[model samples]
Target: MLHKFQQFYPDLERLINFIAISDEYVAKAPSQERFLEVIIRLEREVFGTAKMRGPRVASLRVGEPKNLRDCYDTYKAQKRETVEQVTLELETTVRTLVTDVS
Candidate 1:
């Protein structure tokens, strides 16, 4: 799959190679910032300059919190009620009895 991608986007060969090796050493997916960095670099390479004058195809901030704490808090609040509901279901399941021995 990656070989075919490299063949198609020949200009990204070096970036793809770097990412493959980095993945081996990092053992984790790249962060959003890293993804944006790659996109910006590719845009600059293809356009011959870092064009920041018009609307962009990609952006670093897409309405997401600047830090993990804010994002976590937002999601935690949204999921709190769901978590309570799941806990009640689990407790009920645990207390139920199965009479059929077969």
Candidate 2:
């Protein structure tokens, strides 16, 4: 799964490493609640949000405004921005994880 992801998104190595290390921590957590708490905190610290919540843009309606018809394009642009931001944050988060692990 990871190899496939890397093949498609070569710049995501750091984010993937963060997820891998986080998975290990989550597996070793004492309870599901504890794991959730840790993950939520880590996400808040790294991404500045408790959870990455919501679609990049809200759903469009059948009779949406003319400008709103470009919802798909808006979503794509927002998704790209979010990906860039997450990649930047994950680079620092992964470095922190590596230091802690060492």
Best by lDDT: 2
TM-score of 1: 0.25
Q: How does residue 100 of candidate 2 score in lDDT?
A: 61
**Stretches of model 1 off by over 4 angstroms after superposition:** 1-27, 53-102
Where does the lowest 10-residue lDDT sum fall in candidate 1?
58-67
Instruction: List the global CA lDDT of all models.
Output: 0.52, 0.57
Candidate 1, residue 97: Cα displacement in angstroms equals: 55
| TM-score of each candidate structure, all chains considered together | 0.25, 0.24
lDDT of 1 by residue, 1-102 (tens): 888876877557555644544433433566655655555556665765455545445322222223435446555777776556655765554444222211
The candidate maximizing TM-score is 1
- lDDT, candidate 2, equals 0.57
lDDT of model 1, residue 98: 28
RMSD of each: 18.2, 16.5
Model 2 TM-score on a 0 to 1 scale: 0.24
Q: Candidate 2 at 99: error in angstroms?
A: 17
